[model samples]
Target: MTDQTDEEYREAPSDRTHVKRYHWLARYDQETVKAILDATPLAHVGCMMNGVPFVTPTFFWREGDRVYWHGSSAGRMFHALEHQDICFTVSMLDGLVIARSAYNFNCNFRSVMLLGRAELIKDEDEKAEKLRNFVNGLIPGEWERLRPVYPKEIKATAIASMSIAEASCKVRTGPPIDDDEDYTHPSWAGVIPIRYQVLPPEPDPRNLPDVSMPEDVLKFRLG
Candidate 1:
């Protein structure tokens, strides 16, 4: 945890929330953190088990100030995460910054790091609702058309929720910054932008002949 002066400490302290390196890029605003989380569906969760650090990649969704993820109830990783301290992080690479000098190379990205403990969502009704929201949120109206989650499926899965007790977002955008002398260098330098695009949806071979893609699926776009 980074040390903070008395006045610098937040009312609700998340001791490790501060970004010590490249502090200029750190953003503590709730909206900023939420934006990064909302833009990325994949998250990496880190935790310790048997004195060994483990990081697992999983799909996640955010609602208000809380984040949720689901996994097999029998999985050791989820077992270790439930009711235990964890760090969740999401990052999206936007571009590569090519500079005249190697030392000035950088990446344009948006990222968020959160520190908190996850609580197991054990209530059946609440879990069902959250699962429905997860499906509908990702592709609106799809949940209604799909088969309902069975009680056995719910029993086999574990949903975990972690409040955004302490979080920070870091974003870097625009062009590369090279030394004054590097401006005259022979090498070309600029930002090579990267973006994610939605490709045409492929249907299962066994699908009914009359079925067509839904509007939400056709219009789906990543942030």
Candidate 2:
């Protein structure tokens, strides 16, 4: 795990962080924002390209107040990311709130939006270390068992990190909120819970007969 210092986190909010609608759902605490980011792995990164908007989905991880993501060195998206300001967002849907009236229908979810400029990590050693952290953090003990990352492989990837400079978390949960008159309607209303499940690992057919699943593989879980 990456060591986080007190200075890395602070209650700093920007004009864009304020939630105008449903202001009660906004969360500004650093810890709360970090929790949402940690629970979600996929982030939709939005940036400008040639004076036009562009968004790309990629796997990401958080360490302290910084978020890191990588892509092929040959990708134009990576090139654009390094030179422009970006918005990174992660969201997870928890359930559907079915209400008597269509106007009252909503979904429960947790999400975070961060805005910052990405700094390309150019040091080879630093890149290797961060890459290892990403892999081992996702699957404990897996990095050591796999073949070492080659220099060519490292050279073929572009890794970048962005500070959690301006960020906010918004969440909506609990039962449906309907008008008093709508409650008496014939239609039913409640929350349909949703959860993520991890299935048993499937081994490759070419594996040796004596090989078996590792302890980490059997205990893998996701939020």
Candidate 3:
């Protein structure tokens, strides 16, 4: 965990009633929050343009409790996100938690919804560091292996970052809740675990004969 002073902490008005039964899953430990943030590859950010609203999915990375994403400076999302209120969500499904009753079926998953202000990163050095973080967050040890970004590329792309202060995390685990009457009903109920495994890399026909896949990426594990 990163060290922080008291002044850096902010309490969200929405986090007041965290453990209500209806939103029981919304209460998460710090480790759970970090795990969900680290494992997610993409996030959807919702924002409004004039009277219309939009939800756009894009790649993101987490640094502490902040979420960062980027795109072309002239892109629709990038333009709209600047100086606006945004809500971002990331989710990962682990399995199905089955129960004996029809209403007892539940899902084993982790998700996060963040509310904050989004703005463009204008500093050159900070922009470069954030861009590298976004690329490496998906695959460890990838940023250093890739070639340096061209000057034109930096000028063309825009990076935006939002604080995750006013955020809520929800997770569902274990078996489902069955009705009292359903307890006497005979039915098989259990959980089915899910996982993602990487397939062998496929080479492109136009690639050089000597080119090969990197071991780090080829053997990457989701677990």
Look at candidate 2 and give me any clashing residue pairs. none
Query: Deviation in angstroms for 165 in model 3?
Result: 2.1
TM-score (C-alpha) between model 1 and the true structure: 0.91
* Per-candidate TM-score against the hidden true structure: 0.91, 0.91, 0.82
* lDDT of the structure predicted as candidate 3: 0.74
Task: List per-prediction Cα lDDT, in the order shown.
Answer: 0.84, 0.84, 0.74
Kindly list the per-residue Cα lDDT of model 3 for residues 122-182, writing each as its tens digit.
8777888888887666667788878888777887888888876666677777776788888
Decreasing lDDT order of the candidates: 1, 2, 3
Candidate 1 stretches with Cα past 4 Å from truth are 1-13
Q: What is the C-alpha RMSD of each candidate to the true structure, in Å?
A: 3.7, 5.7, 5.5
